[model samples]
Target: MHILMVSHFFESHLGGIERVAGHLSRQMIAQGAELTWAASAQDRAPVDIPALALPCVNPTEKLTGLPMPIPGPGGMAALWRAVGRCDAVVVHDALYVTSILALVMARMRGRRVVLIQHIAGIPFASSVMRWVMGLANAMVTRPMLWAADRLVFISDTVRRDLIGDPARRDYALLFNGVDGEVFTHIGPAAQRLPEGKRRVLFVGRFVEKKGLSILRAAAAMRPDISFLLAGAGPIRPASWGLANVHDLGPQKPAQLAALYRSADCLLLPSVGEGYPLVIQEAMACGLPVICGAPTDRADPEAGQFLRGVPVDLSDPDGSAARVVAMLDAPCLTLPERAQMAAWAAGRYSWAAMARAIMGLMAG
Candidate 1:
C-alpha cells in the first residue's frame, strides 16, 4: 500500500511524536510499503527517506525583543495532490494548519485518513492560546474526526477521551513501542561515584506539563542522588545552583544510550503524557522506571503497562522516596534485564504499529 505521512517537524526535533513518525515511516518502507513524508520547508534536509517540503507558513520573528507568532499557510491543493495518489494518509500530529488542510483534502478525495492524537488535552498554555486551540479543535479537528476512516491513539486513556460520542467508531488503542535491539545491551554500573552517590536520569522537555518544578523539588529533597536532566526547552536554564542536579543539556541517541546503560533508574514525574517514548526506552535498557500515576490526571493509558508498579506522585516527599528506593535497590541482573527488553521489543515494535495502521487502511 502507498502511504503519505504528515507531521509538523522532522529530522531530529526530538519530540515523541516526531520520533514516532520517523520510526513508523522507516519500518513501513522496510515492510515493502511505499511511504513518503510531507513536512515544513524549514526542516533539515537528507531525511534518509523520500519526502516533500512546503514553505513554513509560520516563521519565527522577533518583535520588540519578543518572539512573534509563525503563521502557516494551509496548503490544501498541494496536500490534495500528494494524497490523491496514495491509498492512505497518516497524520502524526493534528494541531497545525497543514495537517488540517491535509485532513480536508483526504476527505474530499475519499482516501483513508488516520489521525494520531498525540496529546489528550491542552495544558498550561496562555489562556488566549488555549482558547484558540479549543476553537480550532471544535471547528477543524472535530469535523476532521468525522472524515477519518479510523482513529489511532497511543494509549487507552486517549481512546477514552475521543470516545465521548457513541456514533464515533473505529478507534484503536496502540501503545508506543521502542527499538529493543538498540537498548538490549546492558552496561555495568560504574563504581566511580563520589563516596555514596546515585545516578538518576530525567529525559523530556522543561515545560510545565512535564512537571520540571516537581523534579527539581524532588532532587533538592534527595541530596545523596545525582540527577542528569536531558533535552532542551524554553524553561530550562544553562545551569542550576543545586549541586546534586546537573543540566546535561540535550544529548543524541548514542549519548543517551550510554547514559541509560550507566544510570540506575529513570525518573519521569510528568503531569501529562501520551505514551511517553522515554519510558519504553528506559525499560528496553533494563532500567526500572518510577513515574506519576495517572489518577486525577487526564491520561490513564500511561498506567496500563505499569500495572502493579508503584506510581505515586502525591507530593515531593513521596515522589523522592520512590526514586531513592529504585536507585538503592538491587539492580536487575543482565538476564532479567534482557527479559524486560524482550517484553518491550515484542510489545512496542514499529512493525506491529504499522500493521495496525494497515488494518485501518484496509477497512
Candidate 2:
C-alpha cells in the first residue's frame, strides 16, 4: 500500500509527534509499504524519503502554534500530486493548517486519511491562552476529525477529554513507540555516580507547558540531588537559575539513549503530553520515571514502565517536595529494571507499531 505522511515538521523538529512521524515513515518503508512525506520546506532534516518540501512561514511569535500556512500557491500542485498517487494519507495533527490541507486534498482525491491526534489542544501557561486554543479547536479541528477515515488517539486522556462519544469508525488508541534495543544497557560496566548523589534527568523542550517553573522550583528545593535537563527551544534552562540543574541542550537519538541508560531516574512534570517517546525510551533503558503528567500509557503494561508520582502542577513547591519524597522512596532492583526493559522492548517496538498502522490503513 502507498501511504503519504503529512506534518508541519518532520525529523528536524524536536517534538514527540515529529519524532514519531519520522519513525512511522521509516518503518512503513522497512515493512515494504511505499511512503511519501510532506512538511515545511524549511525543515532541513536528513531523512531518506520521497518528501515534498512545501513552502511555509513559521510564525513562532504567534499565539497559535499551528499557524504555518501549508502548501502555499507554489506548493499546491506538488501536494495534490502526492495525494492523487497515495492510497491513504496519514496526517499527524488534526488542527495544523498543513494537516487540514492534506486532509482536504486527500478527500478531494477520494483517498483515505488517517488523523493521528498527538494531543487535543496545545499546552499553555495562562488560562486565557488555553481558552483561545479551545475555541479554535472546537470551531476548526473537530469537523475535520469527524470527516477522517480513521481516528488514532495517542493517549486515553485525550480520547476521554476531547471525544466523549466518537461518532466515527476504525478508531484506535495508538501509543508512541521507540527502538528499545538502542536504549538498553551494555554489560555490567555502568556509568558511576558521585557518592549519595542520584542523577535525575528531565528531557523535553524548555517551554511553558513542559512544567519548567515546577522543575526549577523542584531543583532548587532539593539541592542534594543532581538534575540534568535536555532539549533546546525558544526557552532556556539557565532562566531557572539553580546550581543543581545542568543544561545538556538538544541531543541526537544515540546520545539520548546513552544518557537514559546511565541516569538514575527520569523526571518530567509537564502539563501536557500524550505518551512521550522519551518515557518509552527511559523504560527501554530500564530507568524508572517520576512524571507529574500521567496517562493510561504511563503504566508498565502500556510499555512506558511508569513509576508515577503525584504532584500538583499549580504548585511547583509541592512538585519539588514530591520529587524529594519519591527519591527517598524504595526503587526497583537491577533485575526488576532489566525485566521492565525487556517487557518494553517487546511491547513498544517500532516494528510492532508499523504493523498495527498498516492494519488500520488497509481498507
lDDT of 1 by residue, 225-300 (tens): 8887888766653454788887878777767767777776777766446667887787777766666545222334
Clashes of each: 5, 0
lDDT of each: 0.67, 0.76
Model 2 per-residue lDDT tens digits across residues 1-363: 999999887677677787899999898999999998888787675458878888877775344333354557777778888899999999987777788889999989899988888776655656776887799789877887788988887777676556765623447877778775477755232354555477888998776667777788878878878888889766667777777888899888778887888788888877656777888888778888777655434342653456566555466688777767877788778998898888777767677777887888895
Q: Show model 1 residue runs off by greater than 4 Å.
A: 57-77, 125-142, 164-168, 185-196, 295-339
Off by over 4 Å in 2: 61-71, 165-170, 187-196, 296-300, 310-314
**Candidate 2 lDDT (Cα, whole model)?**
0.76
Model 1 poorest ten-residue lDDT run:
61-70
